[model samples]
Target: MKNKKPKKVFMNGAIPPEKIANSIANHQSKTSIGAHSIFLGQIRADEIEGKTVQAIGYSAYEEMAEKVFHEIREAAFSKFDMTCAHIYHSLGTVKTGEICLFVFTSSAHRKIAIEACNWLVEEIKAKVPVFGKEILEDETHQWKVNK
Candidate 1:
């Protein structure tokens, strides 16, 4: 059955490593899940035009983003034979080398888990209202474009 409760998808800042670890640990008891797929998005210190990116300040239309997230989850459940899925994204500043997004999907088999995780990432990139401002080392910023 699909989880009817709305998930809290946005975090205040960078996602902590411990949180990710705990998530994985929490699923150990679900013996029915044979495989799991995870995707982690980290901020990179990219040098653009002699400016080095130091961090990314994320923002979004929360209500709209939440609604879209729900739609994506529903679609995934309908399309794949997944056991469960979870998505968490940063809302504020996330420094270089820090995690900004975490996507986890599980299923009875490997293929379904992998496919669902990939599809969720793509759908989020294509549809979510989240925006990021790339902050350079000099404190200058530019709007980020997901590639």
Candidate 2:
């Protein structure tokens, strides 16, 4: 069996659109891949009570999160014929409309790409011990939980 190396899945802040574009551009040369599915999780400017959320200050138990991410990656590869996969999650403040999570999966067919993308996202949300502090416009904050 070939040894699979772990990938770096954490970014310091909000994910840039340029990074997503570059990732797509980088895969153009891999002719075997026919489909790509991308999932971007954006911070919402949600109103709670009377305050509007302006940003989310994210933090994580880095080591454990990375391990879970790697496990999810491996599971996706085993369950699907994926050509490549990348998972990135924010580690700090991500403002409203900015991306906090990015999951990119490519495969020879659309089904594999799409399924793997969704699976990785659900797994990450359910398993990762990442915390978020929702920063309201009033400068107050509240803990964010995935729903």
**lDDT values of the candidates?**
0.96, 0.93
**Which one wins on TM-score?**
1
Off by over 4 Å in 1: none
lDDT tens digits, residue span 50-110, model 1: 9999999999999999989988998899999999999999999999999999999999999
Tens digits of lDDT, candidate 2, 1-147: 024888899999999999999999999999999999999999999999989999999998899888888888898888888999999999999999999999999999999999999999998989888999999999999999799
Off by over 4 Å in 2: none
Candidate 2 — worst ten consecutive residues by lDDT sum? 1-10
lDDT minimum window of 10 residues, candidate 1:
1-10
RMSD of each: 0.8, 1.2
